[model samples]
Target: MQTPDQIWNDADLPTRRLAGLALNPSAPQDVLLRLLADGPLAVRMVLCRDRILPDAVVDAVIEHPDTYTRSFFARNPHVDPAQRARLIDDPEWFVRAHLAEGPRMPSPARPKPLPDEAIVHMISTYEDENMGSLGFYQQISTGLRRSLHTHPVAKVRCWGVGRWSGLSADARAALLADPDADVRERAQRHERYEDPACMERELPARPCHGRTDILLNRALSRAVVDGVLTAPAREDERATIAANPSLPTDVVVLLAADPDPEVRRRIASRADLGPDERRGLAVDPDPKVRLAVSVHPELSEKERAAIDYEVPMDCGFTFRHAPEVPPAPEAVRRDALSAHPLLRRKAAGDHSLPPDLVARLAADEDLGVRVLLAQNHPHAPAPLLLRSFLEYTGRERAHLTTRPNFPTTGLAAFADHEDPEVRALVALDPETGPATVERLTRDPDPAVRAALARHPNLPPPRLAELLDDEELAHVAAANPAWDADTIRRLAAAPLDGRT
Candidate 1:
């Protein structure tokens, strides 16, 4: 029944600082391991889930007695997937479920898929305890997906029912006749969607996630497509089916000329467009439609270049999963050098771009291109990372600061900038002098004030002043500049969480 704040504060006010202490970059190994082993759950939560751990601590977490502790690492993005997969056979179901859910942040770049053997083994024998996370698991690799329908294990094969649209006819038939009754039952269920009568009977009458799922994904026979199109109410309803991929060629032709521009936009991205359909959609009245068609797989660079698409200067780009087979270098060069900015933006996403190409795109005129390069390229120069951080206001902006080569010393130059967020960057730079650090202590923005409060180089008097400022106490105490005696006392505090 103890409150989290009460538990933290009753141990002494400094115990409330333990969460911040766990993230202190200069916190030593012995201190981190102690926090891991004996700290309160809140402290351990920060320690295990947020940063890379040393070998000894990783070993401890791998065998941690706490189920939540093990699961925390299951979704930790900083740890390698191979290390995270060590929990696939965990004694607890929640841990395995967490591993199945993949990383919390899947964009910028998703982590590598879990090992194929671990994936196959988990699906074959593990009971998901009704979490249903197994079905929505995102760590699946393309190679594993291709092999799913033929995996030696029947449960793994049965699991492929969800991917029925991608399976070969022979594979589907083999599944339909498999010795395992469950496998046959699943395959039959998927096969039933192919029947127009069943599709009609099961269709949810109104808009809902399930109806949208069926419209966009489940098999739709021409009869149902025609019936829905004939009886349709909203243009979005038609738009949903326009993107179904299972839509008949007739439906594709029908929707391409439909009264709604959104429907046309949805149809434009489909890869199967006949050459004429592709060309017509390219010049569609809707600029969004033309933009969608510009990147269709069938368009050559020259063909895409002719579209009058307007690339949004500040619009953010979404990242696709790393393709199973990487794009060839020559093809990437083609896109990177293409006249169209969208193609160049698409090429900016290839993580393996050679250094000269990364440097070239880093300075590209487009906001999305520079941000994409900063987000994906490991070798993105410090200046690009800094400039992207300054210019970009996306949720991913802070992630830019953590990139390799994000400048540390030279950022003191930004101290007096008009924008407080830009000025806040100077607060964290190790090279910012004591004078600027002192000046920033009173910056109009509380975020700037708090940021400089945590700088280890903040003048000792100011650091002490902020420590007792209730709003800044926890952050100030977290600073690694504290002398040896203070750190030892904070580290050695009994964290049993008993009053």
Candidate 2:
């Protein structure tokens, strides 16, 4: 029953400091304003840069005596145009220079376009690459697209041949005769592909689902339903067809009796089932089918009350929360509590479960299960998270230390953990104080030092030291604290050279 502010106030100095820094810009406005007023200088500096802070916070930060503090508030997006114009003539040259950058200071650099050959490789080699989407391809200018058609690289020409709508007969012949196999293949594929939209509009009269052309037509007409039905159904395709919301009711009913349990499971999830079908599926032989029926939207509240179903917590229905009616029968809750370690672990992740269940799972015998409970459960005890960090080993311990909400009460102990991985995790944790991060900069493990270099809260002086490390330079180049000029210098430096 303790309030967030009370909990925050009771925490040790280190814990309170870390909690302040770890708060996202989106933290409730009242808490952020309180931290800005009473928190330590480091906490206040972080709040000054938060772009979403209310105008009141912005006004206060801009008036701070320290020029460096005022400079940060100047760059924040929350500053109004009037404040921005005032900063233009401020005594601090840094503030004025940054304000002069534009209405938006620290403007993000526009990405340089990829080289033509690189663009070709991106589209021709990877279908899943988002740049290869139809909308992006359509945006290319006709003149620039024509240049690609005749580009010196065969891959570029191959990509062009696939998309060029106005290819001449002679040009198609020449492409087919091209020595590159990719170019010839692309030309042939385009020649054969009639757009699916053509079939959707033109083939309305045809049996939609069964025909090969209907497979090409993504149109959701009656023809598509007939094709899905009349076509010799493949087992792999049946599950997808069963899940399609647009499928005719008769086809959905037919799929309910599908020999494949997965297809039947999919059918049970459909939203348009009748009362009889819901009742019939409620007693299905497959436990998964019955579970799906229990939670199906089509199952009425009246029907749900009438059924004598014993639904387990592991089912997707109640994975995140328990059901209201029947209130997760006592027997089901007991089974979840005593189930195999795996089920108990899953049950612990359900935030709506009683606090006692979460506590039990947190202390479970299996380290992996306990780790899951610690990382996932909202009510997972803080002492439990801290204990795992101290006693456990491997990635689980590392995971506990890196959690943004990881209790910082005993955080200092792990900052010097003999395990380099735990030290690295602590160094990376936003909640770890600057002193610990500074200590870890000299950590024996280079990887730990590298992680410290990536910490957003790293001071500029510490970051400059990280730049001197050849191995950490690439990672350090990505830090937002450095201005464009500094980044350019960093990028221009040889990869093998020290700062």
Candidate 3:
């Protein structure tokens, strides 16, 4: 068996392949445990912190000696939220802190609510000291947040007092009269909300997304509404305020015909829009306003289709990674079958659409519809995934290739393709010739060369050559053809070892 030292004249402590080995879907359970126990930071990250681990690997990672590894695992997004409880009692503060923050980017779907026991523990026992704005994401789940007031633990119920601005009037009164001294005290402390100057003082001198978010969250006093709506120079602020849930009836009527198209457009999104308001906005001169009102739930599919809404085909269109609020399943079903292409596009991104709908959207005429289906739906057919990958070159374009059904075995045929992006797919195929692998190592495109450098079939001599080539060394080190002894040599060596 060739050693890593034999693979390179002098290789820097190699980890690129170690990381790759950790990501191999076919890697055995023991291999994963070994990687978690002995792997470098980069290896541990991919193995324990990125992929969902089997039960054995999960236990090993939970008990791993390295604080850094354990801490990273605390926040691993791919695993069950219930599994996060394994560390709930872990002594490390930051580990508990990360658990408290929930998974990173935890969206595109509402994360399952943490089991009530975990929430009760976090809400009752912890200080809010380490929590930043995202720490407040605890309040984001409506059902869970609302239930906090009824919790058996008084300290847990105390956290609910902080949501006074968002509470139902009945909820506020209940908290104020609560048996728990702490909960009642906290509720009383929030009474400053009655003083409109408190809200006025908190408003920033300049408008920002944060200020806009604050405006949207709180019910503005009449004085605050007057100050906000009078900002003729601040059209954007006025536009954002137009959609505030707490906007009064008269203000709602006033903003419905505000001079700025964006203000009217915001008004169009309001659920409380009267019948006359919806009809008028449906014919607004700005295409954006009509587009906003087109999907109003009150409107029939036929009525929505009749609106002159434009489905964007602009070159710059990009998919939003995680829609903050996933459309209701019924809405997804409705849009999946809608006459309008825009409505179809909305359905295309919903992974929950049944197989029949997934298939229909996979063959959609709109390019955005097809690409979104490919990017979002796990069961998107191999052919559709391939077609969408080729036709679309926008943001997240590369994400399509990583789909589970993306064809890899036969992609060797594209070895000589014109596009370097397509040419790179050749390396992913298991059957690519050693000759093709060697040739692509010198290809014009660095991405193509880098990908091909990691193929198991790459000629060992050329693999050795790339180990010395700084540009490709990391990925070349990631090649999986090295024998067990060679891998052990690399693994046993320091993460920053010299060849």
State the lDDT of candidate 1 residue by residue for 196-269, as single tens digits: 56777788877777777777777887767876788854557898898786788877987888789999999898
Q: Encode model 2's per-residue lDDT on 127-219: one tens digit a residue.
A: 334344433453343455666656667866876796445777778787878888988888766654444444445443433354434443233
State in Å the error of residue 421, model 2.
8.0
- Model 2 steric clash pairs: 208-223, 209-227, 209-228, 210-227
Q: State TM-scores per candidate.
A: 0.79, 0.36, 0.73
Best by lDDT: 1
**Ranking under lDDT, best-scoring first?**
1, 3, 2
The candidate with the higher TM-score, 2 or 3, is 3
Clashes of 2: 4
Error of 1 at 260 (Å): 1.6
The stretch of ten residues in a row with the least summed lDDT in candidate 3 is: 1-10
How many pairs of residues collide in each model? 0, 4, 1
lDDT of 1: 0.77
Best model number under TM-score: 1
Q: How much lDDT does candidate 3 score?
A: 0.75
Once model 1 is optimally superposed onto the true structure by TM-score, how far is the C-alpha of residue 385 displaced, in angstroms? 2.8
TM-score of the candidate numbered 3? Answer: 0.73
Query: Who is ahead in TM-score, 1 or 3?
Result: 1
Cα error, residue 167 of model 2, in Å, equals: 36
C-alpha lDDT values of all predictions: 0.77, 0.56, 0.75
